[model samples]
Target: MRINVLQHTPNEGPGTIKRWAQQNHHDLYIYHPYQFGVLPTAEETDFLVVLGGPMSPNDSFAWIMKERQLIQTLMEQGKPIFGTCYGAQQIAKTLGYAVTKAPYKEVGWAPVYLQSTVIPGVPPQLMALHWHEEMFEIPREAERLFSSDLVKNQGFILNGNILGLQFHFEPEAEDIREIVINDAEYARHHNALQQSPEEILQMAIPPENRNVMFHLLDFITK
Candidate 1:
């Protein structure tokens, strides 16, 4: 399958998603709109994958608005899309939901429970990496899939094809380290809700997390 990826920043590239796509022999074409200032047309790909970034969907940046437009277009065309963190916010904004600052910044390994198990192979509760200060409201008709103590809407599925995730399920240990190094400002929020870099590194991602990611990918592409 031909997959188009929208990478918002240099450091926040597709981690586990890339590995899954390659192992499954799927083609991935990434467009770095932040670096190149251009977003590729999504018509050519069978699936669209939007990765996370530090920027919010509510930002006034011209490129961000354009990216939202692209997402709107893809959804109108009934294109299968998976959005993570900032990407998920973009999806929610496009669906007319409010994307605002979360009450508390959740940074580190956090546990999220599956509110709905419609997405096959996902366990009822699991720990995933978190690194964002913004969250989105669940759009109408979308099933709430994941929810954590800090964020009520960690993930949702709309029309059974579009998946929006507010946490970093695809990040590996190296990916977390790179994000910490690149976006060091997020680490300054010292509180019980937040975890230190060393602490986050010490926490291991469950093996089923990657498997769930792959299962979701296959389900979306099918």
Candidate 2:
């Protein structure tokens, strides 16, 4: 399988998802939409994985609109999309939902409760990792699949083909540290930051989070 990844920034690269792709023998072709301004045709990939970034969904940057169009087009073509944080907000805003400042930013690892009462064959509690200030308003016709105590709309299912995640289930422990370190502005705004690597790691991701992502992958592929 070939996965086309839309990377929005230099620091924020696809993390755990890359592991999944490699483990499953899926080739990943990444396009930095900010630099290239053009994404290769999605017809060549088995899945579309949109990585997270620090930018706001409403940013007037050229790539913002471009990626939106790309995601919209891919969805119309029935392409399976798995989006994280900013990528998820892009999907929501593109699909007519609002992405605004979350009531309170969730900067560290926060466990997200599954909204699906009876997960086909999985547990209901998942340790969802997060690092963002903006949250999407759950879209109409979209089922809220996961929620955190702070953010009720943590992840949503669209057409059972597209999955949008507000948290960072794909974070590579280091990514969590880098994001908090670099985004002191975000940290100050929410006063929701961890001061040290130890503090951040304490919010340690749940072991099953990766398994949950795999389940999502299995669902999307099926």
Candidate 3:
């Protein structure tokens, strides 16, 4: 199956999803709308994977609006979408969901409790790497999927074709390290707690999470 990847920045690639696509030999096309100011062509795709970035979904930048338009078009075609963090916010904004800040910021690995209907191969509950200060309100006609102790509404789904995840389930060892490198800044902005690489490694489930990632790819492409 062919997948179109909309990347927002140089640092945030598909991470674990990239490995899955490569190993499975699926055709993967990538776009950097943030850097190139290019928008997605009006075309149908089997699956659309929107990666995360540091930008807000409500940013007035031209490229940001163009990216949102692309996502809106993909939804119009009934194509499946899998979005992470900022990507999730894009899906929410396109579907008339509210992207707002919560009482507290969520960073690092927090426990996300899946509410039964989210049984798409991921466990009922798992610790997910969250690196966002913002949260999205569930969109209209979307199934509010998961919740966490910290974040009441963690994710939402739209007609089985679109899934928006507030948490990062695709973090690699190096990804963890990068966050640590900027931990001081994150701590200052949100008054967040610091987590070491060792602390994050303790909760790392790379092997198990890979299985879930493949399941998601199959789901979107199907």
Candidate 4:
């Protein structure tokens, strides 16, 4: 399968998604439409994975608009699509939902409660990495998958093939470090939900985090 990834920034790469692709022996391609202004067509992409970024879906950038168009095309074709963070917001916006400032700027490790047993083996509540100020509203006809105390719409699933998660599930240790270094101001913000760089880096990543991500990738594509 030709799995194409839409990466918005250098720091936010595919992380464990790339690993999953490699382990599963599927062809994976990562595209930076923000930098190169190029995106894969629906015909060329068997599956699409949109990674997180610092940008907002409300931004009037041409590339952001183009990315949304690609997402819409895939949705119309019933192609599987998965998005995280800003990517999730982009998907929601494309579906005619609002993407606005969240009640709180959730950063670092936080617990998200699973609203449904869509993904088996995943705990009802698990810690996931978050680094977004804006949140996507649950689109009509989409099932709410997860929620956090600070954000009600943490994740949504549509038509069993489209998934949008407002948190970072694919980032490994190095990816988290790069994110903290590139966006240091996020860690400096003192809040109950936010954590310092040291704390974010030092805390042990739950062993099930990677497995959960792998499960999600398999679930969306299968």
Clashes of each: 0, 0, 0, 0
- Reference-based TM-score, model 4: 0.97
Candidate 3, 1-222: lDDT as tens digits: 677789876666787888888887887788898888765575746678888888898789988887778888878888888998899989898878789986577766777887746446668876678777888898878877788877777887777778888888776777666655645356345534355445654665546666776776666566
Q: Which stretches of candidate 3 lie over 4 Å from their true place?
A: 182-184, 191-198, 201-203
Best by TM-score: 4
* Every candidate's lDDT: 0.86, 0.79, 0.76, 0.90
Clashing pairs in 4: none
lDDT of 1 by residue, 1-222 (tens): 888899988778898999999999989889988778878786786788889988888888898888888888888888899999999999999889999888778888889999986887778988998888889999997999999987889999998899999988898778877887877667666543657777877777788888888888877767
Instruction: Give the clashing residue pairs of candidate 3, or none.
Output: none
Identify the candidate with maximal lDDT: 4
- Root-mean-square deviation of each candidate, in angstroms? 1.3, 2.2, 2.2, 1.1
What TM-score goes with each of the models? 0.95, 0.89, 0.89, 0.97
Residue 103 local lDDT, model 2: 77
Q: Local error of candidate 4 at 51, Å? A: 0.7
